[model samples]
Target: MVDVFLEFMLGPMRAIGDYYFEHQMLFNAIVIGGALYKLASGKKRHEREAENCN
Candidate 1:
């Protein structure tokens, strides 16, 4: 039944939502730091490639 499927899906989703709410700051910090690291590394890689081309 749809109810059964919804319960099954929502149960795990609810748990994940609760966990995110409880550790929002930690998650935000991790996401932001990861994004910054990727951007910085990508810029450096492009610069290196440009130097090699020249």
Candidate 2:
């Protein structure tokens, strides 16, 4: 029962898992870049709002 399910899923999951580990650094860079972009954009938006109020 469980063995059958595990075996069936493992085929597809194994390929995805392998690619993740292989390009792990690229993944890390993408995550970090997104975070930085969000931070910079938020700061700019705050400044614009403050200018409009004043």
Candidate 3:
């Protein structure tokens, strides 16, 4: 049932999936770094706001 809906786009989806898997390690590292950077910067901004309020 689901295969019927998914069959038409599977080729391109598989290609994209393959490319990501080929560079999966690098892709994961970049994603983790960006997430950590965002977390640190947001914490800093929140700290500054709290300090300003006090």
1-54 per-residue lDDT for model 3 (tens digits): 866555576855876866888999999999999999999999999999999999
Worst 10 residues of 3 by lDDT: 3-12
Q: Which ten residues in a row have the lowest lDDT in candidate 2?
A: 3-12
Candidate 3 off by > 4 Å: 1-9
Q: What is the lDDT of residue 43 in candidate 1?
A: 100
Write one digit per residue (lDDT tens) for candidate 1, span 1-54: 976776678976776776888999999999999999999999999999999999
Q: List the residue pairs that clash in candidate 1.
A: none
Error of 2 at 11 (Å): 4.4
lDDT of 2 by residue, 1-54 (tens): 975676688976877877888999999999999999999999999999999999
List residue ranges in candidate 1 displaced over 4 A.
1-9
Clash pairs for candidate 2: none
What's the lDDT for candidate 3? 0.88
Candidate 2 deviant stretches above 4 angstroms? 1-11
